[model samples]
Target: MAETAAQFPEVQGGGSLIVAWQVKGKTVLVVGGGEVAAGRILHCLNADALVTVVSPAARLNPEVAYRVAQGQVAHVDRNFEPSDLDGADMVLVAVDDPAASTAIWQLCKARRIPANIADVPPECDFYFGSVHRDGPLQIMVSTNGKGPRLASMIRKFIAKQLPSDAGRAIETVGQLRVRLRQIAPRPEEGPKRMAWMSKVSEAYPWDEMCGLSEEDIGNLLRFYPSGKVPALDELKAMRANPGADKEAFDGSFGFSVGA
Candidate 1:
């Protein structure tokens, strides 16, 4: 057999989980019906995926059971067959049977389906990761099929180091995107406006910056190519002075002309 070495980076257990695939809105087939299967489904849904699980094994986690009952999942009560992977976007096999998992792996490969075997890393295309959540913000940690328990432990440590309001800040920024676009400036001016907005956000509390009604927030500032920037023009005029030595002061000074 040919030997190969693959590079799998250490997971931080806090941030920096790299994705092999983005399965959002894609079909995923999970083979097994137990707590492990439930966990796999939970993470899949967290990415906003469409999931289907093979049934007839055992009870699932209560959360997964509830999601199934709520019509958020589809169940196929049966055993593994290559046909089961037909049209599947991805396949996850969490059965305790290593042989079964390996078989599913081969079948998936033959069908060109992306496969993950929870217990058999050699057969998996991707692995489930330890996950950390701070509200809407999630950090996924994967050791590329090693030390999941250690990953969880590391996640706890990293979670403590993160700012509590990170998720809220992300949400606020996401909410601000449309408004920013609607008031778009000239292409070259966009970066300057973004810099100013970022400074304003950092100077103010998240709640205060994000708390205004959408309309009121929209009206707070608008950027345009024809925008009257008297203060900016004044600064530019000052910079035009013969002995200003502008480049020496540009980096350190927060204020700038045409910035």
Candidate 2:
């Protein structure tokens, strides 16, 4: 008999899977008004979620009150009710009463909704990791709710190691991708377009990529047909003299990947 292939369990490791959930324009119900709840509210706002806070007016802390006053978030000046979960896409529980929080979590689970009970790993469907944000770039460090402070420290260290222009590079590359799609609109051209873009990304340094202007992007598009990665100096020359003859670029310029 032939040896059987090894079978594996669904969860080989015991940790929460980190994901960037797009909550934009979705309803997020936050059931509390303390500091923890304030933090949760801010996170929801940052993702452009439609947020509603359910807590008594007297319970709201300064941060939450300020947001409510500014019309940044809708507020229900009362204790959380079952109806609060009616149209909530997601729920966050940060009440002082652990029992209340757990009950809310159970209610969400019964309704097939995701919920995060602050500091309760078992009840939480998701944990907010320490995130470092730079323009369009986001770096998150998580420790499965084991060591949040340590995760924050690690996030800071990682952020420090990255180039200051890293975010700008990502933004520039994103725009380049849009341009590339326009130049090669056919579905069959995807593989070749991806290969060319990959080559261009690997060839240029972050700062140089960030410096790329409209003319530089046009120069890059010219080489997309041949799938050639252009030399850095040629791009620099084009920027230096924008009025220079385009026909002069023979597409024979020597290319070198930046160190």
**Best candidate according to TM-score:** 2
Checking candidate 1 for backbone clashes, the offending pairs are none
**Can you give the TM-score per candidate against the true fold?**
0.67, 0.83
How does residue 97 of candidate 2 score in lDDT? 91
Candidate 1 regions off by >4 Å?
1-17, 57-64, 185-259
lDDT of 2 by residue, 1-259 (tens): 1234345444468767788898999999999999999988988898899999999999999999999999999999999889899999999999889999989999999999999999888898888988888888889899877889999999988787766556877888998999989989999988998788889878986655755677788887888898898787766675657546443332232221111
lDDT of each: 0.66, 0.84
Shift in Å, residue 135, candidate 1: 5.0
The per-residue C-alpha lDDT of model 2 at residue 223 equals 85
TM-score for candidate 2: 0.83
